[model samples]
Target: MRPEALALLAAACWAVAALFSAPASQRLGAIAFSRWRMLFASLILWGIALASGGWRSLDASAFGLLALSGVIGIFIGDTALFACMNRLGPRRSGVLFATHALFSAVFAWFFLGERLWGWALVGSGLLVAGVMLAIVWGRRGDEQHGWEQTRGRLAVGVALGLLAALCQSVATLMLKPLMASGIDAVAGSALRMSMALLAHGLLLSTGWRGARPLAPMRLRDAGLIFGSAAVAMALGMTLILQAMKHGQAGLVAVLSSVTPILILPVLWLVYRRRPAAGAWLGAALAVTGTAFILLR
Candidate 1:
């Protein structure tokens, strides 16, 4: 498959995982859900790495970089994303999270010295406008589905989602050079997850009340969490890194953040209601912005 297709496939994986995330994150709480998800992902990736001898390519320097990348990307970013989901639900949260593509472009411009002066600037404005539009008007006044209910302050969830996007972009930027140099995607991903799992372990050991799950995990919750962990962390993220080996960071991110567009149909199916007009318009703007960056 082409690198761009790999990025889109990663987006599909994330969209499916987002469907599971609302339930599991609500049941397990964001921190605990993330802990379990990273644990599962770490183990699965390690199994693949060892079996395929991908671990052989992991030097100490590679380990250090990938490990830090994992902690920032998966540990902080995934936790914040789920916390955002807990408050904003998946659909709106997804629109917010899609800003990572824009964030990645900006970060690349500053850090990697990638140029961003043409259509990219216009797209950035559109992306920001779309995010605000979705958050402000994505739901009807009468729409009271569990997924659309605001859990806490709207401000807090929006902050977390954008923070998740920023962290994701930074982490991806950090890994571009390594991935482009032919690192084994599986082993590198395993190392990253392992480091993130370690971070979660320490966070749990702190007995921070906020870090604990509100309820015990049910069998069904376990299934949901495992499936999401396997699909999103083990497969989707690895595919993004693989795409990075050949694709430009901005293009890859723009494609991978198509999660907002991909998740809407499933959301409609589950709710038995079409999305609000604002949701459709916001998604169209965000996707068009992505295409501007992609095709430029």
Candidate 2:
């Protein structure tokens, strides 16, 4: 499969995980949810890496870069994202998260000495426009699902969401050079997950109220969180890392940002109602944008 396709696949995994993650995050809280998710993901990724001898690829340099990426991207970004979700819900939070594509593109141009031109640039524009349209106005006027309701302050949620996007983009930028030198995607992800989990552990051990779980974890919620960790953190992130290894950061980020559009069908399935006109229009634009890059 193409690298861009892998990014899209990662987005799909994330979309699936996000659907279940809202409830889990709501119950577990952002910090606790992220910690548990990373722990489970670390176990799964490390198990695979060890079995396949992928762990051998992590030199000290690679380990250090990945550790930093994990701290910023997974530890900070993931926690902030869920915290935003705890307020704005998945749909709105995803819209804010989609800005990572723009951040990645700019970071690539200024820092990585890379450029996005021609149809790829056009596609990026369309994708971002589509994402904005879809998530901002995709729902029906009369339909307000629980996930559509606000839990807390909207401004705070927006700020956290943007912070998560920036952190994620910066973390991805940090890994580009390392990925170019080649590394096992699974091993890299495992290292990142481990580092982030360690960070979360340290934070929790400080007795920080924000890091503590808001409620006791039920067995079913634990299973849900584990399932989300396996798909979103392990599989999705591994695929994204692989894409980043071989693809342009801007293009890959743009392609993966389609998570907002991809979530529409699932929303319809879960909510038993078609998306509003904005969803269809946004989907069309995003699809066309994706095609521009793929066909270029």
Candidate 3:
């Protein structure tokens, strides 16, 4: 399959994970949940790397790059995102996070010399607009805490969301050239996850940001966190790295940003209720924009 397809698949995986993670995050606290999830995902990726002999291909420099990317992407970016979600609710946080596509595109253009012009630019704009529309106007289920509840901390939440976007975009751009140079995506993922695990461990140990004492996880919470690790961090991130290997980093980011749009159908199916009309329209616009990018 093409890298674009893989990126979309990653988005689907993320959408599923997001649905499952919210409750666990609420129960465990964002920092605790994120730390556990990263540790779990690191172990999974390490096993895959060992089994596939992906571990043997990395040299010191590649290892360093992958580790740095992991620190930025998983440790910093994901933690900030979880915090943002906790503060602002998923809908508003998601809208801000989607700006990662624009950040990725701009960074890739200036730093990596990857350019998007004409239809690609238009498609990217439309795609971003559609995602923002869906997130802002889409049906709010019971899961999301209402935006009105977050008014007091809206500025902080927005800042954290933008920080998450920046970290994620920079991490992806950092990895693109390495992956293109024949780095093993699985091993690279494992290395990055391991680094992230260490970083989170440090944060927890230092009691940074009032990192609460490790909460006891209920069976359901454990299950949800593990499932999220497997699908979102392990599989989704691997697919994203592979996508960056084969496609423009900006384009991959744009494609992956469709997670919000993709979640509409998932929500409808799971809840047996339809999204608002705006969601349907947003999905159409996003799909049309994606087609332009792909077909152009």
Candidate 4:
């Protein structure tokens, strides 16, 4: 498949992952769920890498880079993302994460030296403005009467989300160089996941006190969460790497920004939830902006 196609696929996987993740977090706290998700996903990726001849050909340099990527992107970025989810909920968090696309653009320009087109700049402005309006308007009617309950973690989430985007873009920019230097995609992915697994393990241990979770896990919820992990870790990472390996990371990032748009129809189909008028408008603006960035 083409890199553009793979990027779109990655976006689709993210959309689906978001859908399942919210409920899963509600069942098991976000931190615990994210930890397990990364752990399980790493196992799946390792198995695939071993099967793909990536196990025997690992290089220390590539390993180091991948490990760094995972630490910055998965460990710090993901931890912040979940914290945002817990505090701000999915809608606001998702909007904040649009900043990731902007970050990716900037990082690609710097690291990969990918130049942005005029249309891309225009689209980015629209996306940022639209997302901001959507988030602000969405929060307007919330139960919180003042900014106190609404601001802190939500602000952090937006900041972290932007940082996460930058980390991911840099990771993508680095991937092609590593691959050209003989780093197998599967092996590279495995290395990234392994670092995430290690970090997650330490966090889980630190967070787990003598007491168990406030609520018990259900078997079905466990299955769903694990399944989401597998998809995100194995499938999502694979597609993203595939895209980065062959496509300009900036273009890939812009294309993958379609995740929000992809989620809209899913919400209607899966849960019979229709977005408000402002939401639909925002979503349209986001989609139009993404198209501009991608097509131009």
Candidate 5:
């Protein structure tokens, strides 16, 4: 498939993953769900790596980079994101995550020397503004008016979102160097998941006090969540890394800025949820701006 197609496919898969994961978060708790999700992803990626090549094909440096990426991006970024979810709620957290594009662009610029054009700058600004508008104006089922009951959570959400963005940016920036040095994307992804596994283990051991046992789940729910995890987080990330290998970082970043749009339709379908008109408009604006940035 073409790089753009792959990136869009990845985005779609990520959206599907989020659909199943929201309920899982409510059931198993976010930390537990995240850990198990990574565990499953690690196993899947590991098998793919082994099928493609023996373990010996992975070098120490590549392993190190992947490991670091996994820990920082998956464990730290994801954990902080879950916290943001609790504090900011999904709508606000969703908007904050749009910041990842800006952070990623900056990281790519400094480390990879990826240049942004004038339209790209304008588009990114619009995208950020759009997402913020969406969050600020969006209303939930519980909220009759937009921005209701978001007092303390907003501040915490912003901080956590910034942390998530920083970790994600650093991890993404590291990918270019690793791939340039000849790391196989599949094997690298496997190693990254392996690091995530270790981090999950640590979190379970130290971070999750009074963690609940795995709850009994319906076969349908289990299947959906697992499928989502494989397709969204693991497969999507692999495709994204592959696209980065073949495409410009700025373009890839711009395309990825539309993940929340991919997310909205899925949420509507699965949960019968809909964003407020303002939120929808904001998302549209963000996508429009991001598109301009990429195309120009």
Candidate 6:
């Protein structure tokens, strides 16, 4: 499959993971949940890497780079994202996080000398605009989590979301050159997860302000966290690495930003209600933009 296709698949995986993670995050606290999730995901990825001999290709430099990427992306970016979700709820947080696509494009242009032109550029704009539209205006029944209750923390949440976007963009851009140079995506993912786990663990150990006391893991919470780790951190991240390995980083980021749009159908199925018309229209625009991006 093409890297673009893989990126889209990653988006879908993230959409599913978000559903499982939101409630758990609310219960567990963002910092605690993120730490545990990274630990769980690292263990799973390590098992896969060891079994498949995926670790054979990495030298010291590649390993270090992957580890750094993991710290920035998984630890910093994801922790902030979960915090944003906790404060602003999924809809607002997701829309804010989607700015990672723009950050990735700018970083790729400045650092990697990658550029988009013609249809790809237009598509990227439309895709981002569509997602913003869907998130800003699409609301149906109880699915809406308005910012009214979060008015006090709105500024903080937005700041964290922006931080997450910047961290994620830099992390992905940093990994692109290494991935393109033939790093094993699975091993690289495992390495990054491990590093992120360590970083979070250290922060917890140091009593960082962001770190919260973890509630005892109940069976249901364990299941949710494990499922989220397996799908989002392990599989989704590996797919992202693969996409960056073969595709332009900017294009991959923009395509993967469709996670919010993809979540609409999932929500409809789970809640047994249809999304608002704006959602449908936004989905159409996002799809049309993706088509433009994919077109030569």
Measured with C-alpha atoms, the lDDT of residue 128 in candidate 1 is 57
Off by over 4 Å in 5: 1-5, 54-57, 140-154, 206-221, 271-274
How far off is residue 10 in model 6, in Å?
0.6
Model 5 has an lDDT value of 0.70
Task: By TM-score, rank the candidates, best first.
Answer: 2, 6, 3, 1, 5, 4
Measured with C-alpha atoms, the lDDT of residue 31 in candidate 3 is 83
What C-alpha lDDT values do all the predictions have?
0.85, 0.91, 0.85, 0.69, 0.70, 0.88
Q: TM-scores for all candidates?
A: 0.90, 0.98, 0.93, 0.82, 0.83, 0.95
Q: List residue ranges in candidate 3 displaced over 4 A.
A: 140-152, 270-272
For 95-125, candidate 5 gives per-residue lDDT tens digits of: 6776777787777787778886688678767
- Write one digit per residue (lDDT tens) for candidate 6, span 129-178: 89988877767656634321363468999999999999989999899989
Runs of candidate 6 with Cα error greater than 4 angstroms are: 141-152
Clashing pairs in 1: none
RMSD of each: 2.4, 0.8, 2.2, 3.9, 3.4, 1.8
Number of the candidate with higher TM-score, 1 or 6: 6
Clashes found in each candidate (C-alpha, N, C closer than 3 A): 0, 0, 0, 0, 0, 0
Higher TM-score: candidate 3 or 6? Answer: 6
Off by over 4 Å in 2: none
Error of 1 at 254 (Å): 1.7
Candidate 2 residue lDDT tens string, 180-201: 7889999999999999999999
lDDT by residue (1-296, candidate 1, tens digit) is: 77877988999999888877788899889999999999888899999999999999889878888988988999999899999999988877887788898788878778877765688667656755665566556676787889878899999999999999988999998999999888999899999999999999999898899889999989999899999989999999999989988877876787787777667777778877777788788778877776676566
Candidate 3 residue-wise lDDT, 135-196, digit = tens: 78886454443432574467898999999999999998999889998888888999999998
